[model samples]
Structures are given as structure tokens and as C-alpha cells.
Target: MLFERVESEGLAHYSYIVGDGNEALVIDPRRDCDVYPKMASKEGMRITGVLETHRNEDYVIGSVELSARTGAEIFHADGHLNYRYGEAVEDGMRWKVGRLEVEAISTPGHTLGSMSYLLRDSGGEPWIVFTGDALFAGDLGRVDFMGMDRAEEMAGLLYDSIFDRLLPLGDGVIACPAHGAGSVCAASIADRKWTTLGIERKRNPRLQIESKEEFVEDMAVALEMPPYFKEMERLNLVGAPLLSSLPEPSPLPAREFAIASVEEIVLDTRMELAFGAAAVPGSLSIWLGGVPSFAGWFLPYDKEVLLVDETGDPGEAVRRLRRLGFDSIRGYLAGGMVAWHTAGMESSSIATANVHDLCLRLDRQEKERGWILDVRSGAELQKSGRITGAHQIHLTELPERIGEVPMDRHVYIFCGSGLRAMVAASILKRRGWKDLTVILGGLAGWSSAKCPVVK
Candidate 1:
């Protein structure tokens, strides 16, 4: 038996490939589907099946594409919990790949069709369960798919699923889940790749709660759904274009950077992690996933733009840009921002103000000097004690509405942790507004600072 846990840092998603000597199966695959084929060739394994635990509301799933390419059957538990599995499986039903026998355990609290696969080797004790968002290393899946109204019901379902379907398996059953930290699907998932049910049973906060009512409220970490979830869901439902090869990036020459953008498009394929580590002064604050999407939507008119890349994986940022039709990135940051700094180019930084800083500013009445803007989603505002007089709007709407902010006042924008606030600050700066600062640690920092809360 062979298992590979594929992790995508940008999306905080984990996909799995399990195989016997003869066949392989993939679960919850990301859209970049090239590596699987090469692996199949190297291992002399035939790609046979693709499975989706649920219609994911996160990064695009690559199941259909893989199915189309490898002629693997696509299985999704949708109609009356039916699927198109080459080896159909249901609760209590056993599936075999050589010596390995796997069972599908219905654990639907996270999503209606969510599943966990329990695996045993040659009639031996069960070793691991792929708990697809139903359970994580230190957290249970947030009952997000059902929306806020059914929180109680979903929480109850989750309670039953864990008590009956999962916890009974004993300590040795390794818990492998679909997502880890940075995935909005769970409130508090540890970063560990694999953990035991026994460990989670002891350390996991949600597991400690006795009542479903308490679990629902405790699991509510107040996360905004991914901005692209709706579109991705739709694409997943029908189909998305399968890539036979990774999008070929033009080797952008240093001289033709601007003209290439004008002729083709601009992709800022700089790795976001490096961007966060050190950024260009006046750089936009969108140094995370969906950067191309956000940049295209707001700053769409950059016809001859150049990419600002990190030292590694320069193509990553370009591909995302090309995905969104920003393929005109002619070249990188012309030896990167080090070149800019060496040449004495002016660089600036946006302050990450936490909740405490906001408290200090508001209490000291310093907020009057800098425009206090809140860029969290509407859902976040529903239950929070937000800054009293801070102007409320979303990060997506900033470019259009930025003009309303007074130019004379210094601007301080913040969100859950200064992430979205930085995005807003970047958009504001692009439109020529000068005075800007992104509140660090955002509301979390503010709250920890003993800042006043006005719920």
C-alpha cells in the first residue's frame, strides 16, 4: 500500500493518492493535475479512480479533469447518496485494492455528502480514516455548508457522527483530514500532517464539549467564506477545463517586460510568502491566494505590467495571473526589489495595527487623525464589537468607494488580523491616496490589547 499526502500551501488544502501495485485513487484533488500522471508512470501504477468527499467550496477541485485525462471513473456522493465509483462504496460496505480494504463512513455534518474512509490491511485492525473536513488533527469541521440557520442541527449531526462512526475506532486510527490551518472551513486546526483519534480526543477543544449547542458556538470562529467560493462551486458542479499541461509561461525578457504585457497580459507570479516577507513600497496588500483575481477585478487596466517575484518559483505568480487573463507580465521586478532598494528607490510599509492599537487610537482620540476604516465582511460584523465610529465596508469594494475617504486625514484600515485591511490600503494607495496604514493583528490584536469592544 502506498499513500501520498499532497499539500498546497497557497490554499491550505491536502489531497491524497492511495494505491496498490496495480491501481491508484485520488481524493479531493487540486486543479493542478499534472504530477499525478508522471507519478503513475514512475510507479507503474494505473490511475483508476477519483473521489470527491463533497462539492468543495474552496480551491477548484481537479477530479473531473483527472477522470477525463486518465479515464478514471469520477465518483461523487450526490443523488440519494449515490456515486459513479468504479467500485461503489457505502456505509458498512468494504472496498479492496489488493490487500487493503476500505470502508466509507458517512459523516455528513461538514457537508451533506462528506465522507470518511476507514482502511484496514489484510483483515488487520483499522489503521487510518480519511476524515474529509469531518475531523482534523485538533478540530472538527465547522458546520459551514448548511449555513448559519441550521447550525444547531448540523452540530447535532456532527456529534452523532463522531460518537458513533469515528470515536469508536480506538486510538490507533490515524486521523487524516482534508484541510489544515489557514483553511476557513475549520475554526482551529493544528498544522500536523497526521494525528491519532486518541490524541485529538484528549486535546481537541470541540471533542471536550458535551452538548451540541456548546459545540456549535465554540466552533464559530467568525470566518468569512472565501470570496471565490460561489464561482468555484459553480465551476465544480458542471466542469472546469482540464489542463493537459501546466499553462506555459513565456520567458519574459527583462527588456520586453512592458511591451509583452501590452501585447499579451500581466501575471504577477511572485510567490505570496516572499512578498509578505518583504514588499515594494506602495505595493498592493494582496499577497495571498486569489491575488490574480483580486488584482484583475480592481486594477484591470494594467496592460503593460511587470511581475514582482520572490527569489523562488517566479512562475507561480505568473500562472495565477494568466488564469485570470493577466498573462501580460513581461518580466520580474527587474532583479527584484533589491535592485529597487540598491538604486535608492523609495519603499514604504503599511503598519499592521491590532485590536489594541485601535483601542489606543480610539481611546486617545488619535483615530480622528487617521481615517479608521473597517474592511471585514458583513458576516464578521454581525456578532462582533467593532470599532465604534470606524467606517465599515468590505475589501472588495474599496477601489470603487475609496474616493469617499477624505484625503486630508491619515488612513488606518484593519480587518480580522490586518490582512484585508492591507488589501484595502493597497487599493487606496493605487488610486493616489497617500496617508495609509494597515492595522496589524487587526481586531484580534485590538482585542488582546484590552481595547474597548462595542458589541
Candidate 2:
């Protein structure tokens, strides 16, 4: 079988391709579907099937569009017992490949429709197992997905699924998983894409445990408390529905940029050093230290996009935007802000506020010293401590909690780092909150300086 892993760095997601001699299956494809066609051609295989382990939330799925474009059949498990699918795969349902026998094993922990695939070569020991999101190399799928109550229940099921269905496949079975160290989908995954079941049995924390409750509680502490998860779960009820292909990010000429900026949202994508010296007023800053994800949180879906990559890597910015389906990039800012300045147009340079400013402001407790909004999650606050005088709020809940932030005060937003704080500041500014400032180098920076903590 010809197998390949498709990886996206910014999102830390991995997709895969596996094919017997005749046909290929694309698994967990990224939104743009950039690599599948080339891989198929190289292997001289026909693209015949598309399979999604679970409907993912991190990036848009490419299943629907790819299926529509290629004559590939889409496969998903029937969720619950009576679940239906385009191609319903279930426990012990075996299918034929050139030299391999593939069968499905329901492992519903991460989500309701999760599945793991077992493969047998000729008549020897079963060669490989596709442990979708159920079992990672060193780690296991996060059970606190779907819904908390449901997630808890699923966690118990996950324990049974792993120790019984997956782990019992013997020591020599090669564990070929869909996700690797790159995915945010699991916690503490092994960096390698494949590991032997024997190794996982000996080293995996999930397998070493005996009781279901211990397994459930152990998998509970996965990273992230993202607000987008609920929405992802809603989408996963059906599927993440992958995209077939995306249009190239249309770049605008210098003249077109000025015209578009009148209506478009400006995305400054140039090197941070260049942007720091001279930048656009009201432009969202996405630099090396602060990548586009944080800025993307506040970026609305409908606005026309204007990129500010001076070195001409605006395509990278557009790829990040496309993951959210924000494809309406009117054009890029040609020649960047330098072109605007050359034409004598105005520019705005923002201050990178240090921890000292945060300390002084918190100590003073001035009513008019601008609004102090904390963007750290409740869990993070619970563990790491927060600024004594700052407001307690998570960035994910910002849209709903806008009322708590007074419209009259000069809104100053912050998170673990300055990255998210900038995004929060933009959101407040977009909502008509005037005199907005993002507290650069958030609570971590404050903590580094031994700033006093309230908790």
C-alpha cells in the first residue's frame, strides 16, 4: 500500500492517503485539498474512496468537494446503532483490497461516529490497524469532546474500546493512526505516524490502567477549552464536509488596494520588524510571534480581505483565512504599507505595552485608566492565577460578554500572551468600543516580572 501524510503547520493538522495497487483512499483531507491529486498520480492509483475518522473542527474538511470532483465513495460509520451513512462501515465488516483485508471496529469516544480499521495481509498476522482518533501512539483521544455529560459516558466507552477491541489485536499489529504529534486533536501523541500495538500496550497510559473510571479521568485533562468545539460538534453530527479546492488568493494592484481598503478589512502579513516600525491604522497585525490564528478569532466572515505581506507571501495569510471559509479576499495590499506611505497616505503604529504598564495600571485601579479585560480561559485562571484588578473573562465568550465591558471605558484587552489580546482588542473596536488598546505580552509577561496575583 502507498501511504502518505499531508501536514499543515499553522494548524498542526495531518491528513493521510493510503491505497492498494489499484485505488486510493483520502483520509481527513485539509480544506484546500492541496496534495491528494499529486500523490495519486505518483502512485499510479485511481482515487476511489474518501474516509473521515470523525468530523474535525480545527480546519474545514475536504470530503464533500473531493467526492463531488473525484468519483470517490465517502465512508463514515453509522452513529448510534441504527445510524446511516453513504457507505456504512461497522464492527467486523470486512472488505477486500489487493493484498489486504480491511475491517471496521467502532470506537466511539472522541465523537459518536468514530471508527478504527483493522487490516489483514493474506493469511498471516493482521498487519496494521487504523486507529482513527480513538488511540494515538503514546496518548488517547480526548474524551471531553461532544458534550460533557455525553463526553463522560463516551469516555467510559472509549476505555472499553481501547482495552478490548484495539489493544487485544496482539503485540505485532502495526498501529497506523490518522493523527500524529502535529494534531491538536489529542494530548501527548507520539511524534511518529505509526507505532506497534505492542509498544502502545507497554507504554500508553490508557492501556496500562485497569478500570474504566481511571481511563476516563486520565483522558479528561486534554489541552484546550476552545469555544469553537460546540460548533464543531454540531457540524460533526453530520460531517465537517471537506472542500474540493480553493481559489488562489486574488492579489490587488497598488491602485486597487487603495480602492479596496475603503471597504475591506486590512490584514498586515509582512515581517513583524517591518510592521512594528510603520503600520496601518486599524489594521490587524499577524506576525511571526503572533500568527494569524489569534487574529482570525476576531476576523468576521463577510468582510473583503486586504493582505499586507511585503515579501509577497500573502498566499500563506489567505490559506489561514480559507480554513474559516473567509475566501472573499478582494486583493492584497501591493507594496505593503510602504506603497501607501510613498503615496503620502496615513499610517498608524501601535505601542507594544510591557508588563510594567499592566502592573502600574492594576496598582492604580483607576476607573478611567481604560477597561481591563482578561482573555484567559476560566481553567487557565484557576491554575495560573490572574491580575488582581483585571476583569475575569475568556476570549471565546467575548461576543456574548461584550455587555460587561463598558462602552465608555478605553477597552484594554489581554490574554496569556499579547497575541490573543490584540485579537480581543480588534473585536471590541469593531463593536464600536472606542479608545481600544491590547495589553501586549499578557499575564505571562506580568508573571515573569513577579507581578502580584489576585488568586
Candidate 3:
């Protein structure tokens, strides 16, 4: 049997291609799914099946697109909401790919119709289990997606699915999950690549709880769901348009880019320092690495996006945005910010301050009228110490909670390492808030400088 795991970087999503003899099956594919077919071709196998564990909430699934490209049959769990594409697969349903047998196991917890696929060897011994969002390396899928009213019910169902259906499949089965560490699907997934049922059963903190009631209670905690999730859910259910159907982002000269920025969303995918130094006026600063995780929070589905990357290549940014269901990319600045400067186009820059500057400013906060805005997550604030008198709003929740940030003060934003702080600054900039400054190195620099923090 042949197996390959493809990891989509910014989203930290995982898709797999499993083959035996001359046929292969792809599970939980990402929207840009050419990797699967290319891998299959290299292995001298034809992709005959595409499977989804559940309706994805983060990135657009590539099931329909892959099926169109490879002539593969698409399969997903049955009895959930009606999916517009793919055949509805029921529990215990089995299919043959080459000489390998793949069976779908009903494990509805993350969502009502979540399924886990068990792949058996030629001798009928279970070798690997595609747990989808049901299980991860160090954590289980969040059970709150079904809404707060049914969170407990979903958690209870997840407990039963893990303790009964999954663990009983035996400890040795290699467990493959749909997401990894950076994904929003799980709060604290392990960074490691490979894990087994035995490893997770032994080391997973949540799995250590024996009582179902306790597990249910523990898993019912609410997490901030991204606004784009609703759009992703809708698109994934009805199926997304193929990549070929979408318009490719072209390179536009600085003069043309300036005109486009007025009508389209301007996204600058450069580092925090570069963005802080100088950027296209009114462009949103997300940094190329942050596009997949945070772009959905700020970008609207209706508007076209014009990108400005430092390398002058918006291909990566476009891919990341498309993965999160942002398909209306108009184009990118041809020569990036340098070209804009050469064209004598107007530019904007956000001020930067260090941790020491923050400390001295805090000493004179009453006279300076400066405010510190912490954009880190609540979990990070709890794990690490927090700055006293700083207003706390998670970066993901900034859009809805923007009012809480005082408009009269000189707002100094800081995140874990300043990447998110820059993004937050851009959000504020777009909202017409002036006197913004990003604290360089953020809390890490504060600690390194022996600054005090409140627990």
C-alpha cells in the first residue's frame, strides 16, 4: 500500500492520498488539490475516490473540484444537511481502491454527520484510520460548532464517539486527522506530524478524563468562530466553483493599482517591519503568513482584493485567500511597494515603539493619554502574563469589538510577536483611527527586557 500526507501550510490542514496496486483515494482535500493528482500520477496510480469526513468550516473542500479533474467518485457521510454534491455514504459502507478496503464509520460529534474512515490491509487488518475532525494528535475536534444551545449535547456525543467507536478499533491503528496545530478546528493540536490511536489514547490530555459528564463539560467551552465560517459552511455544502472557473490574479502597474485600490480591498502581504516602514495608503496589513488564518476575519466576500507583496509575487497570497473562500482577487501590484514609491504614489506608515518605550509611556499614561491594546487570544493571555491597564480584545474578535477600543487615545497595539499587532493596526487604520503605533517584539520583548507583568 502507498500513503502520502499533504499539509497545507498557513491553514495547517492535512489531506491524504492512499493507494494500493493502481488505484488511490484522497481524503479531506483542500481547494487547491492538484497535489493529490500529481502524487497519484507519480505513484503510477489513478485516483478513483474522493472522501470528506464532514462539512469543513475553515477552508473550502476540494471534493467536487477533484472529482471533476480526476473522474473520481466523491463520498461523504449521510444524514446531515443535504449536500449538493457527492454520494451520501452511510455507516459501515465500504469501497475498494486498488487492493485496499476503505470503510466509513459514523462518528458524529464535531458535526452531526462526521465520519471516520478505516483503511484495512490486503489481509483485512486495520492499518490506518482517517479520523477527520473527530480526533487530532493532542486534542479532539471542538464540539461547539453546532451552536451554544447544543454544545453540551455535541460534546456528549463526541465523548461517546471517542470512548466507544474510535478507541475500540485498537490502539495500534495509525490515526490521521484533517487538521494540525495552527488550524482553528482545534484549540491545542500537537505540532507533530504523525500519531496513532495508541499514542493519543495514552498522552492526550482530554482523553485522560474517564467520566463522560466531565468530558462533556470540559469540551463545551465556547470558542470564537470566524465570521467566514458561515460562508465556508454554505459553500462547502453546495460545492465551490472549480479553480479554472475563478479569475486568476494578474500583475498590475502601480498607476492601475492605485485606481483599483479605491474600488477594491487592498491587502499588503509583507512583514510587520516592512509594512510599518511604508505601505500602500489604506492597504490592510496581514503579512503573507497570516492571510490564511486572519484574512477571513476582515475581508468581505463581495469585494475584489488587490494584493501588494514584498516579493511582487501574489501567488501565495492568492492561494491562501482562495483556500479560505476568497475568490474575487482582481490583481496584485506589479512591482510591490517599491514600484508604488517610484511612481510617486502616496503611501502610509504606522509608527513603531519598543517594549521600553511602552513601559516609560505607561509611567506617564495619565499625562500622555496613551492606551495599550492587547490583541492576543484569551488563552494566550491566561497562559502568559498580561500588561496591567491594557484593553484586551482578541485579534479574531476585533471586527465586532472595535467600539471597545477608545478612539481618543494614542492606541499602542501589541500581540505575541507584533505580526498580529500590525494586522490590528491596519484594521484600525482602515476604520479611520489615527495615532496608531505597534509595539515592536510585543510581550516577548517586554519579558526579555525584565518588564513586570500581571498574572
Compose the digit string of candidate 2's lDDT tens values, residues 195-237: 8989999988668877777777777654665544444444444
Q: What is the lDDT of residue 215 in candidate 1?
A: 73
TM-score between candidate 2 and the true structure: 0.75
Candidate 3 per-residue C-alpha lDDT over 1-455 given as tens digits, one digit per residue, 9 for 90 to 100: 67999999888999999998899999999889889889989989999999889989999999999999999999976456888998988999998977789999989889988999999998899989999999999999998898889999999989888989999999999999999998888889998789999999999999999799999989998877889999999899899999999988989999999998999999999999999999888889998888888898899999999998989777888888989889999999998888899999989999998887787767655566477899998888888888876888998888889999889978999888889999999999989998999988756556422236877
The candidate, 1 or 2, that scores higher on TM-score is 2
TM-score of each: 0.70, 0.75, 0.96
Write model 1 residue lDDT over 171-235, tens digit each, in one string: 87888888887576786688776789999899887899987678767654335554456655665
Which lDDT value does model 1 have at 297?
A: 49
TM-score of 1: 0.70
Candidate 1 backbone clash number? 19
RMSD of 1: 6.4
TM-score-better candidate, 2 vs 3: 3
Total clashing pairs for each candidate: 19, 5, 0
* Residue 163 displacement in candidate 2 (angstroms): 1.4
